[model samples]
Target chain A: MEITAIITALCLVLGSLLGITGGIGVYRLPDFFTRLHACGITDSACAFLILSGLMFQTGTSLETVKLLFILIFLLITSPTSTHALAKAALNSGETPLMEQQQTQQKREER
Target chain B: MLEAIYGASCLAILAVMGLALLRAVLGPSAFDRLMAVNMFGTKTVLLISVFGFLTGRPDFLDIALIYALVNFLGTIAVLRFFEGRKTPACYDEPAEEQKE
Candidate 1:
């Protein structure tokens, strides 16, 4: 029981650390696409860590099953949302920062 | 030990939420704000789940799940709204219209 508790604690800490880092990335990243990468970290790594920690605390139960379901649902939706956002941005003429830099470099070369 | 862990994690999550909120408010572009809002929603889901465990109320997990569902739907709807408003046909329109 104590071992389980320790593991849960570790998971929570690690998850929160990832979340904080992701948040900083969101705040400080240079471009929209880069910030999206930060959100992906939180959406995937942070969420999985936190949910698994909660599952450890709950043990084998219906709640655990539900938590697992949520994790799966989140894993599926987070990326889908990111993709949708990126597609929407691209469709609407939001050129990626990297691509812009490359085009500028090519023009300068000419 | 568990209580301490829960409390610390909650505080960390709150800090993250604050940063996300800052991004939402200060984001330079529509999509940036949109991404910030999405990130905020994700953190809120985490916060709710952690609170559930902290308070010994597993029922909050149900709430967290609902938030997750709502967040995803909300993101998709918002993005779709943007896409519809700025369809590729309008690509030749004024830059002013695209900023929205």
Candidate 2:
């Protein structure tokens, strides 16, 4: 029980740190695509860490099963939604910052 | 000790949520707003689960699960809504439009 508590605490702290980092990245990143990358990747990792920590606290029980389910669902959907958002943004003529810079460089070379 | 850890984690999660909300409000483009909303939803799930454990009512995990489902669907649906439009307004650059 002592070991489990330590592990749970470690996971929770690490997850919270990651979550805070991701949130800042999303806010401070320069481009939509970059922000999407930060949001999509960290969202899953943070949730996984936090949920698994909670699972550790619960040990083997129905709550653990539910946490597992939530984890799986988030893992699947977070990326999917991010992909859909990226595709939608691209389809709607939203250009990435890098692409815009590249085009400007090309125009300058011309 | 565990309770104190839970409380600290909760405060951190709330801080993250506030950052996400700031992004959502200050996002220069529609996509940024959408991304912020997605992040916010993800944090909400973590918050719900941690708070559930903190309070000794693990049953709130059910609400977290359902929230995760709805958030995904809502994000996708909103993305689809934006897909049909030609170009969403970008607040950062008003003089340029995507021609294409």
Candidate of highest DockQ: 2
Error of 2 at B9 (Å): 1.3
Per-candidate alpha-carbon RMSD to the true structure: 3.3, 3.2
Over 4 Å off, model 1: B87-100
Candidate 1 residue-wise lDDT at A92: 81
RMSD of 2: 3.2
Candidate 2 achieves a global lDDT of 0.86
DockQ of 2: 0.78
Could you tell me the TM-score of candidate 1? 0.90
Which candidate has the top score in lDDT?
A: 2
Off by over 4 Å in 2: B90-100
DockQ each: 0.59, 0.78
Fnat, model by model in order, equals 0.73, 0.89
Model 1 Cα lDDT, one tens digit per residue, B1-100: 8988988889999998999899888757778878888888888888988898889988878887887777888887777677667554343334656688
